[model samples]
Target chain A: MRQILSIATTTVGEAIRRRVLLIILLIGVLFLVVAPGLGVLSARSETVVLRGMMLGIIQLTSAVIAIVLTVYMIPNEIERRTIYTILSKPVQRWQFLIGKYLGAVFSLGLMMALMTAVLVFVFWLQASDQSLAAVGAMVKAPTMYFVQMSLLAAVAIFFSTFVAPLVNFFLTGGMYLLGSLFNPFFQTLQENQGTHPVTKAFAGIVNTILPNFANYNVQNPIINPTQVIQNESRYYLEVTFYGLFYIGILLVAGILIFDRREV
Target chain B: MAAAIETKQLTKSYKSRAAGNINVVDNLDLHVEEGEIFGFLGPNGAGKTTTIKMLLGIIYPTSGEGFVLGKEIGDMAVHRLISYLPERPYYYEHMTGLELLKFYGSLFGIYDEAKYRALLEKVNLHRDMTKTISQYSKGMQQRVGLAQSLLNDPKLLFLDEPTGGLDPIAHREIRDLILSFRDEGRTVFISSHELSEVELICDRVAIINKGIIERQGKLTELLHGGRIEITVGGVDEAFLKGLNIPDSNIRGLPVGVLMDMPEEQDPNGIIDAVRNRKGTVISVVPRRKRLEDLFVETVTNPALGGKPSVPPAVAEEIVK
Candidate 1:
């Protein structure tokens, strides 16, 4: 356990030292500043514009955080031969993988929190004359966004364990895109199933394997305020649980693959 | 007593993309007793680093087996007893020297910071402990690398070119440190291209070439006993022409008459030749062979010409 903690701390220290954390912060701040400008010419209501901006920022920040951090961690260590010092010890390979995953997750978690704060602040600024209930709804949307990003981070780690960082980045990014596009594609297939049973079945199989990123997207409720579904917290919580479950499974797979890696 | 390290037909071959398979380490056997500084000598790309990496379990061998502290290597438990210093010292550049040591110690399950601190002081790195490793000089980095290897006070230490970049003083300090480790009953396996340094510190040495153990034994046994120089005065070129010494026996002359003579072989014949002359004998100097010359001779040609298995007993006694 202590060894895992040591590995974790080292991984975190390495991540911070690489200025990855700083870059994430800079991107998040930039997104927050630009999000309000989209409201100016939009035909959508102010609440809707704010919510869209919040959702866009969350998705963009989470995807970047997951892909960038996961891609570099293992490759950098192998290049530096730091992995040798750690592997020479009595520690197991699985421990090293888990420790790295958990450490990177911690870094991503911190970035998500900071981005969430900026999001809330932006929503508050746009809600000057609005009711507290409306502002509260806007603030609540990001909770689901965090769960989605955490899941993406786990998938990125899984790819990193077996492939090079650049390939891993492309793979995880593609998966994130697929996950986001899956819901609408699946719904369309289901609606046309009377004439397209084969296409519907293929969509069903992909839906089962890929994460349902769209389920955690709550931006519409924040933007259209009137669309806020009351007592829908249970659905949000279930999605969060689902995200955690997938992250856990992917993390286990990553550990197994990493253990067999010769390095 | 068990051998500190032993390998039986250990081999490793790397598969190359641009070329055919290259055997980095061929089927080879080796053994080093406990408390001995065993020098693993080989030229660059002679599989020296590969052998060390296999011993540390950093890489798996293509075939054969090895044991460290009587436990089969590439096993997690055996790795715990071994400490390795790579040829090029690389650490967490962002970490301070002390922090790097502490981190390595922690991985080895050494929780006490005090113990690691003492090790740093022992390696003469306590003063540089707080400075980031990136800011340190090459010598200082090497010292910290040495200190890190000693973090757990491992029974078997694998050092790959520990003195490569060190200054003369730093090199001596490291050599003394290695000697001290042996004195404490620990075993050190050192790989180096520096033959003289190896000869100076190693209890026994193994010379590997093309992934095979070319020679292995105590330093003394490998070197030839000595050379004999018989200088005769008052004998002109006419008398010298009458002598029947083989060209192989003559080692050139400012000081004349060089010959490799056995100790037991009677010096009477040569003495007679000089005494019978109308001239005086200047000197007969017996010179013992240096390690470097022996190393060159053995490595160049292990077959020291198909003479007798042993040299004459008298000359051997003089060397002993």
Candidate 2:
């Protein structure tokens, strides 16, 4: 455990210092700060448009950070020969994999937290008339987005063990898109009475295999004042559990593949 | 002394489109006793790194057995007693020299600041402990690498090209450090192309070529049969021949005669004969057979199929 933590801590230190990640994070923060101005042109209520835009910016930026941070995690170690030194120690391959994954997730969380903080300050300044409870409620979406991006980082980490960084980049991005946008469609198609058996079976397989990234997109309820989840805390807990469970599976599979791999 | 590392018929094979399964390290048999610096010498594509990787368990061997510290290869218990410093090693640039040692030390559950500091000091990097790796020179990085490799206090150290691409001072510093490892009773297995460096430090050596172990033995044993050259003035070839030196090559020069004899022969006899014949002795040069000559002979010999052999002089030196 100590070995894993040391590797994890070192990885986080390196990841946070990476110029590309910091630049992506800066661009995200800049967009969130400018989002209120863009919300003025929207046809919807100003608060609703601003909330949606800010959440969109956070989600998009976090996704990019997660992908970019993790896609090269394994490859960079091999390229720089750092993996040779680490593996030559008593450290197991699984420990190294888990440590790298945790580091990526931690770095992603830090970047997401900064964007969230900016989102809160901007929303608070724009809607001072709103209650503190309402502002706190607005922070919940990014909290869930953090869990969502952690899952995304895990997806990238898993693919990175076997594939090149460029290929893993596209592969992880494609999975995120499919899971976030089309997962529900696939789920719905599988349950529809009119759906063909072959299509239903295929949808069922994909829905089962791909993580339900959309489960954590709780912005809909938080964005519109009228919308509400029946049991908010229970819903959050369930989705958080689902994300953790999926992440566990991906890491386990990745460890198995990396154990036999020659670096 | 127990064998620190032993491999029997160890092999690693890869498939290629041009050829079928090719062994990168083929049926290799090697042995290194405890508390000695053993040099693994080979050409660029001689599978030196592959052999190290297999012994370190970083890669699996295709077929065969290898033991480190008397445990089977890939056993984690053996890892606790071993450390590897790869060719042109890289450490985390963001880490200061001290922090880098701490990080590697933590791998073995060691967190002693004093030990880390001492290791840096030993490598002569204690002064630069606060400098991040990026601020370091190439030599400093390598010194820091050595510092980290000692974090676990390993019994066996695998150093691949420990002094590669360094200046003379860095080279000497690293060489001294490696010699210290052996003096401290640690088995050092080095894979390097630096024949002169190896010659200076290694007690024994093995030369590999095209995935095969061509020669393996003590440096003194492998580097045997040097030649003795005697240059003299005013001595006729007939007079030198009359002295009747066996297995000697006597060439006539403008000034006198030159006698090239095996080192085993007494040079005093030839000098005495030259003097008695009224010849003035110019010089007696003992051409010790170098590792480089033996290496070239072994690596390029068509008879051994690119295996190890002594040069013509050493071979003749042996015959005499």
Candidate 3:
């Protein structure tokens, strides 16, 4: 645990200093600050448009940061020969993988938090819903996005153990897109009896294999202000546990491949 | 003395589509006695680093077994007693020297501030403890590497190219520190191409070519059989040439006629031949064998398929 924490802390320090992630974060913050103007262009209520736009910026930026940060974490260490020094110690491959994964999570959380602060200040300044409950409600989606991005980081880290950074970048991004935009479509296809059996089996395989990244985005109702989830607290807990379970599986799988890998 | 490192038939191979399996470190036997500096010498792609990696458990052997400090390879318990500093080592540039030490020290569950400071001081980087790694010079970085490798007070230290690409001052500094490690009773296993450096500090050395141990033994034993030089005055160069000594060179020095002959030749016979010509003997100097000669002979034996470090023409010129 001591070795893990030391590696984790060092990784976090290095990650936050990476200029590319900071640039992605800066772009996300800039868009959120100007979201009020874009809100007026939409036909819907200004608060709804502004909230939806800001949340989208935060989610997209956090996802990019998560993927970019993790895809090169292991490869860079190996290339730079840093892994030789660390692994030569008493550190295990599992501890190293977990530490790197946690560091990515911590760095993504920091960037997302900065973007969220801008979202709150912008939303409060533009919307008439000035209640603390309104701000609390607005913050919930980004909080869930943190867990969502953590899972995405795990996916990227796992691929990084076996693939090159460029390939892992595209692979993780494709998985995220599939899980977010098409996961529901696949899940529905598996459930609807009218669907072809051949298609159903394929859908079932993909749905089971791909993480349900959409579960975290289910908090979209928080920003839309009209839709309500039944038993909101219970649903949030279940989704968080679901994310944790997937992350645990990905890390263990990554550790197994990485242990046998020759650096 | 107990063996600090031992390997029996340790082999690591990679599958190549074009050529079947290429054994990188093939069927090798190696031994290192405790508390001695052992130099592992080999040309590029001679499996030096691969062998070191396998011994350190950074990479696995496809077949065979290796042990470090009485424990099986890859055993984490042995890691607690060993450290490795690789070629051109890199530390986190964001960290000051002190922070870097603290970071590596924490890996061993050692967080003593005084110990870290003393290590830096030992490596002569005590004043640079607060300077980030990005600011350290190449020599300073190597010194810092040495400092971190000492964090565990390891029983065995594996250093790959420890003094590579450094100036004379830095080289001497690092060399002295490595010598001190042996004096302190720590076994140092160094993989280097610096034969002269190895000749100076190593107690034993093993030369590997094509992933095979071609030669392994004490430096004194391996470097024996040097040539002898006899310089005589009042003797014509033709007088020494007339001797027609096999595999010997007769040349003229400003001071006298010089005859350079192999160590296996009887110097008494050569001296009598010179005296029969009434030659005045100036001096008889024994030219000790160099690691360079042995390395060239082993690595470039036409059978080994290694390109000669010395061109064929140059070798024939000296022999003639």
Best by lDDT, which number? 2
Distance from true location, Cα of A111 in model 3, Å: 1.3
B1-320: candidate 2 lDDT, tens digit per residue: 89999999999999999999998899999999999999998777789999999999999999999999999999998889999999998899999999998899999999899999999999998889999999999999988988888888999999998988899999999999999999899999999878889999999999887899989999998998999999899878788777777888989877767889888899998888778877799999999999988887787685775444445564434222
Candidate 1 lDDT over residue span A183-236, tens digit each: 667756766737477887887777778888888777776666468666797888
Q: Tell me the chain A TM-score of model 1.
A: 0.88
Worst 10 residues of 1 chain A by lDDT: A187-196
Question: What does the TM-score come to for chain B in model 3?
Answer: 0.86
In order, how many clashes per candidate?
A: 5, 2, 0
Deviating ranges (above 4 Å) for candidate 2: B233-235, B272-280, B306-320
Q: lDDT tens digits, residues B1-320, model 1?
A: 57999999999887899877877788879999988899887655668888887887777888999988898887888777888887777888889988998888888778788887898899898887899999998888888988888887889888888888678898899888889999988999999866667878998888776677777888767664665666666565445546654432544356444444544344567668767876656777766666656545544553643222223342233123
- lDDT-wise, the better of 1 and 2 is 2
- TM-score, model 1 to reference: 0.84
- CA lDDT of B148 in candidate 2? 88
Residue A144, candidate 2: alpha-carbon lDDT: 95
DockQ, candidate 2, comes to: 0.88
The per-residue C-alpha lDDT of model 2 at residue A142 equals 92
Candidate 3 lDDT over B229-294, as tens digits, reads 999998898878777788889888899888888887888887887788787889898998988777
